[model samples]
Target: MLRSSIYHRPKNNFAYAYDEETLHIRLQAQKGDLQDVTLIHGDPYIWENGEWIYSTSSMKLVGSDDLFDYWQAIIRPPHARLRYGFICNDGKESLTYTERGFFEDVPTHCHYYFAFPFLNKIDVFSPPSWVKDTVWYQIFPERFGNGNPKLNPTNTLSWGETPTQSSFFGGDFEGVINHLDHLIELGINGIYFTPIFKAMTNHKYDTIDYFEIDPHFGDKETFKRLVDECHKRDIKIMLDAVFNHSGYYFEPFQDVIKYGESSKYKDWFHIAKFPLNPGNQLSYRTFSFEPTMPKLNTENKDVQNYLLEVAEYWIREFDIDGWRLDVANEVDHHFWRLFRNRVKAIKPDAYILGEIWHDAMPWLQGDQFDAVMNYRFTNAAIDFFAKKQTTVEQFQNELVHVLQSYPQHVNEVAFNLLGSHDTARILTVCEEDTNRLKLLYLFQLSFTGTPCIYYGDEIGMTGGDDPLCRKCMEWDENKQDLELFHFVQKLISLRQQSPAFSKGEFSFHAINESLVSYRKTLGDEELLIIINPTNRSLKVKFPTSFADSIDLWTNKHVSNDLMLNENEFVIMRKMK
Candidate 1:
């Protein structure tokens, strides 16, 4: 039987012709219906010195939509060559072509070295539409590791002597930069930094100056270097923006606290009275009870302008990929709407992820944010597998509900994580059971929403709440958990190559309390993941149709009674 292939180019909305080599192409049709499709990749005519020069030597397979339903690849050329396109193998005399798109014209920089590539191109590749369905790793700067002693905090007492809220162990931007290769090996394409802005606390949330880079981490020049270095590796950096509040020493807050109602910043805060006594206990304010961390009066025009300007400065100057808005829901929606519009106007691809734990469908209503942190999914998985709080049915229901609730695009962009700076580490929460943790980890990574791993989760670093969980990076033998670390790396690699794991639609089959099965299918590729979260091993029966597929993790064939040992999972890929 001969397969037939067709070529079609998607409509582009913006100018600045795109390089087809940089774009991701997906072939959509019924499975096994199309004939052999050959994808011919090439560079556009570049305006070098004077005239245009056609650069060739680029070629790639029109990869299977069964493996990858969407065509996505980063277009890169030596230096800043702006012109590129592709030649499709549609069995016709003339090859189908795409207009040359400028790589520099896009808002976000592509991190090819750190990410998995559809094709190995000489030029670094940009992220295609399919890249959104990924697991992100959020790094808390001060807690990650101390790669450079010179960049240590000057005012040690400010953050305190311990590892908790009052403590500041030396963790710097260089530490993050040094570990770029480690992260790449761990399978995290995107890196999220907690707060890099200058602040008085270990957790940069109590932002002292939004404009300046924290001296403890390094100077502004060093921050830029970090961005450049990470970009070269294809890793996107997402910085934390604590816009709803400011530290006590912030200029506006200082003025309000020092001059009472007479101060111009009095309006910037929710002050209740005039002429406040310098010595008197002031009760008037917004947000939490923390006196040092004053909630900004977002209602004020000047206040809003100041914060928005700060955001623009980072995007324009640093070329940061995106911002993770802290305490996002606390601020005004009107301000967020304006803020989002401003950001998109500057960089359409720049993502704005909100930090809201509860049901965040309201924020995802529209332009407010690209996605919110998916805590419900993470929490439910932990409860079912680690804490033994509920049955697999409970976990499966919660997972289905979240996916069905949001629009396809919105759900695709959601940031899902097993652990973060604010909570206990996933491995620690699982009580250091590498096997059980592996089951939970696979669940989160393979599930529908985007998965984000805490910095140390890949290395199997463990700690409890606050200070304990905030322990320094321990590369030494006594502290390292190699088994857990390698497991994470393997899972990450599997995710990148498996189309069903990356871009497939999620559908689950409900079994008894001990077992749950889910399917992720994209065109000809079908992946079935069955998890048994209980202590006893059992033989589970699936519908008769699954009799011919091969288990992905273990290359074993399956039929009616699929056997999964205690705390084991079987990932099968159906082959026709």
Candidate 2:
């Protein structure tokens, strides 16, 4: 037994409140160390004759990474509080584990056990129930479509023209309305639009007006119609919120520039100097040294009220379903809490997604954002699947870290994406290999969390980062990759029709250097996905014998020995 490798805690992902009544506890041990482990737990106050009376529940070996095996137990304490310990057996001997570390004998006192004092309902990490099953399609509105050329900005270029940072091709809400069938046909249930608020740039990250829709994108009435159209089709809309900074033309920032230190709105932004210098990044804190965007002082009461009111106005008036906060990590935590409360008061099921690129445990504790754009998931998948820069073992470990970083609820709604407006298209990243693109989509759609497909990604569009990636949507069917589109459509269709896709417990295995296999199990329903990332044929042995199983891809019965061709994959599900 590797005593030093045993690990557990009564907080975060290890032991967390699945709900007001249930607590999910997990323990970690060195891989292949313990044969059996059991949870010994009881209410902290449940003591008889100076001895703590407890119940024992066997823990399931959920998963194993390169170095550790994860064990989990779901318990419902009678009084919503628990003092727990673990008993491990390696076949030769047994040992008792507690808060005080290893002990030869089980401790009788409650203090010797780990404690979950109370399972508070408010602290439970609850995101929108709809988000877990949602298949999000991220739309960069400026480039998606153009249904209303009359609303185009002056000197707008023709559609499909080469894109520059400031270029516009007149993509309007009417255009999106016209293309609703495209998304529907592709099976998208959620839309995440980059900022549509009135802004200077086509991308709209630099907000000029929070309340008004960009005329280039259409009027507020058109946007409301768009919202109504989406809801009618059972699709949800999530708009971007750029509260971290304001554009150079933003009213408050303009006022600060005009009046310098004497402006009443001076407190709204972080203005370092009396004479405003818009060209220098040092004049005031901006969004990553861009002088055009001045950082907002979210700590100000007026600023908080203004932003929160803007947040409330959209939900109350437009009935927008969600807010995808831009540069969310730079914003203050208190403001987000206020924003969450205000948004939830209007719509309790509203998803608050943040654009945070790193570990975001602090912001996802049920008090602030529901989940961040899962860039960690993005980078790992790219490194392993797209770039081929990481070994299979390393890829599995990286993903395990991501899954273990958050509670189960957080992972469920995590905005997992392969590419977005901010990054290069996945096809381009794979060097235009349609085979590799297929592999990427297969992994993403089948993995845990709500997966997002960037606009044009499903149709095999390829471009580099930023301006190049933000090209106009190919309206011509002949130019689009219909086969790839159909493949993606099939994946989304499978996800919607199966509970295991979104609700199952996910586990990834390092099958070999060239093949990846993962399983999703929900009760007796289980799906095992195997992929071959190389150009050569590969075979994966069945992880276990299934009583009755069928290959979901070919819709045929499968055998234990299966050969997968280059860039080929299979989703095998157990049959009743």
Candidate 3:
């Protein structure tokens, strides 16, 4: 046995309370190093005359990447408090693994094993239950729709006009209200809007005031009506919170500039010198050197209290469903913990999403944000499906690493998005190929985590990154790709109707270099999804026993031998 390759941890994703009664333990080993693994667990306080009492539960191989094979064991600690270790096998020899080191057999003393002191239900990392079933739509307010032309800013372009970093088209809450039916018909249940607070920029990431809605969007009453309308339709609304920094025009930042060293709010920002000087040298820390966006000092107690109140006031007053914290990774974890407490106190189910673009395990421990904008998914999908820069095998390996990075509950509610305001539209990434975009959508909407569609992406809207990607909504059906829209709409409908698609265990199977196959299974319900992204037609084989499974797209039984054309796919689900 390769003792050096065996590893286990007692907290976070490695070993966590899946629920109040159940504990999910995981182990990592060099790929193909271990033949079988078992969890040797027992209550810490329970012991016999000599040996400590224990039970062994076999661990199932859950997933693998290029370097490691992951194993999982699910067991219920009778007392919710336990000590555990792993027994690793190499087909030739068996060895017991413990906190100290490897031994010939399971340790007799409880102190030698990894300890999960107690499973407090409060520490179980429970996010909102509704998130698992939601399909999110991300809207950049300035580009979505223009229902009120009267609210247009000076030099505001017409609806459907091209977008620039400085351009505004007057998309408001009333416009969102006018177009709610479009989302309803598409089966979207959650809307993740970009920052809408009062700000000078059209994107609104720089917040001049956290308490007020941008006048261009609408007054507080109009937004209230929008939220209530969405709730009536069973849709959840999540607005962006840009507490990471304050805009140049923000009151506190302005006060600091006016008073300099004697400013009462001087400590609110990270100003390096007394006299504010931007022409010679940038003295204050700003958001990426933009003098307008000054990063907030979240460590300051006054700042924390002010931000926490802003987090709660919206939920308490308008009954908003969620807050998507912008640049959340830069903000201190302590402030987020306080933010979570205050928000949850007002509304227990309010989804707190963070704008984290990478590994966010630290913030997802259930005391901070509920989920993040899943940019890992964006990068992986782009490299494989959109750019064709990676082989199918490499794509599968990247996905495995991402899935194993967090616990199953976190994965269930993790925000999954293919494209957002920060990236090129999904269709453009596919080189304007509707077929390739379809393949991307099929995988995203069917995979675990709540999927989000960037506003104009459902149709065939195509643009590059940043300013180019933030184009106006296509409301004219004559100019839209209605065919692609229907295809996406159908996928959303199928996802909402099938439990296997919305919330299910996900796994990928390696085929040849071009074909992709994955399974989504829940209880006895299972869905086998196959996609062929290459140009040549190919025939894919499914399990022989699944010959009579219903094809989710056509609602007809398909044969074991399935042939898929270029960029073709199928979703086959077994009858429950």
Comparison by TM-score, 1 against 2, better one: 2
Which wins on lDDT, candidate 1 or candidate 3? 3
**Relative to the unseen true structure, what is the C-alpha lDDT of residue 419 in candidate 2, on a scale of 0 to 100?**
97
lDDT of 3: 0.89
CA error at residue 229 for candidate 2, angstroms: 0.9
Which prediction has more favorable lDDT, 1 or 2? Answer: 2
Best candidate (score: lDDT)? 2
Q: 502-548 in candidate 1: lDDT tens per residue?
A: 66767776555578787788888888788887778888877666777
Evaluated against the true structure, the overall lDDT of model 2 is: 0.89
Q: Candidate 2 lDDT, tens digit per residue, 374-448?
A: 999999999988888998788888888788778888898889999998899899998898887888898899888
Q: How far in Å is the alpha carbon of 111 misplaced in model 2? A: 1.1
Q: Residue by residue across 324-417, what tens digits does model 3's lDDT show?
A: 9888999889999999989988899889999899999999888998888788877898889888999888888888888888998989988999
Give candidate 2's error at residue 27 in angstroms.
2.2
Ranking by lDDT: 2, 3, 1
**Top candidate when judged by TM-score against the true structure:** 3
